[model samples]
Target: MAVLETPGAAGEPEIEVQIRGLMLDPVTNMPIVVLKEVGSDVVLPIWVGVFEANAIALELEKTETPRPMTHDLLRNLAKGLNATVRKVVVSDLRADTFFASIWMEQGGETVVIDARPSDAIALALRWDCPIYVSSKVMRHTRQNNAETAANVGADDLKRWLENLNEDDTGQYKM
Candidate 1:
């Protein structure tokens, strides 16, 4: 089970979210991993590189590769070392870059490893663990969306991101 710390402020709870889908950004043509808060309308989109996106897509579709992929190898290594992946957290956003932490347990000891949001998410899927996002990051995303909306002279970006449905995430190609 995933354990999250209580927020210090009201309306600032650590949100448990799921991978809504993965799609390509129309403008930048970058891969975006869309995460939606459980039982809520809040959404967070993190743009990622092509290779990382490919790793996520492969797992998302449950495609089997003849050889173990990097994420697969990591999962195997953890198991071999008697480590269990507890959870993954999208812990922070800084200068438009998002950060994540991979929480693991080994021999009654807890370990936290810093990672990119994309990598952490990929590992989370492999481990079948819960994913979380800090309320502060969600607030920052909303603020950034507003700023982007204003600069774009329309709320298209925000609207488009918030309104993405499962069908909108077509097969992500390399």
Candidate 2:
């Protein structure tokens, strides 16, 4: 299920988004996690480090490793502690960087942990939790990579998804 939050009385609602794909940025040669809104054409591409992208991609592709990865360990730890990850929020974009928070609940108490968007996204995928992007951040992206989704048809998106290859994940070994 998807979760959206308004930070305060005047805050904009967070919009739920899903991972579209992980691919290497042609110009930067860095990995990027592409996210798309569930019922809209809005898309956000967050450039991430190579290894973290691999972690997200592995979960997206349902590839199991012989040993638990870092995200796996964190998920298992939360389970061991009886903490449920309610949602992962990509809450802000400042100084050319994105920020996120992981909302968790345990023993009738709720907690929010500051996290990098990449790491929080990986854990969210593993836990089968929803991912949200603040409207504020969405506004910022509208001037950047948002056109990728705004003008594409469903068939185009499907073809793009179908063409994703292992090589597109960059040089990281999963």
Candidate 3:
């Protein structure tokens, strides 16, 4: 079973990870965003809702929306306030749910906001901020990865994405 640490979880230092990709879980038919440690096989899969998944996928695919989406609005608001999104940290995993904090810098002061991992991830992508996973979270996820063999080859993932229909992305609202 996978271990998940709650917020304020005391353990190892956080390890930086990059967004590997966004794909649908074959079994559950739910969208999952994959994160991978640099130069390592460690991977974390966070299942997300349909709407948030679409937001992340749009950013990943670099598809420009006709107007600002929620994430884009957040990015624009930050810019207007002269704040920068320093980074987003996937801080914990509790009860199979991941939590995150979005760190922002304004006027030399840093502010951290509690956010769902999916929203944090979407905003992070728009702001071009770095993404990190707490080491405890990673260690727990990695252990689970070993047992379930959750790693998917790049080719397989690419093929899965390629086969998606336009409507599969979900409809967008203004």
C-alpha TM-scores of all predictions:
0.89, 0.79, 0.78
TM-score of 1: 0.89
* Number of the predicted model whose lDDT against the real structure is largest: 1
CA lDDT of each prediction against the hidden true structure: 0.84, 0.80, 0.76
For model 1 the local lDDT of residue 132 reads 89
Of the pair 1 and 3, which is ahead by TM-score?
A: 1
Model 3's alpha-carbon lDDT is: 0.76
> For residues 39-116, what per-residue lDDT tens digits would candidate 2 score against the true structure?
875667788998898898888878999999999999999999999999888888889899999999999998889999
Query: Number of clashes in every candidate structure?
Result: 0, 0, 0
Q: Where in model 1 is the C-alpha error above 4 Å?
A: 1-13, 171-174
Q: Which candidate gets the maximum TM-score versus the true structure?
A: 1
Span of 10 residues, lowest total lDDT, candidate 1: 1-10
Residues 68-130, model 3: lDDT tens digits: 999999999999999999888899888888989898999999898999999999999998877
Better of 2 and 3 by TM-score: 2
Task: Tell me which of candidates 1 and 3 scores higher on lDDT.
Answer: 1
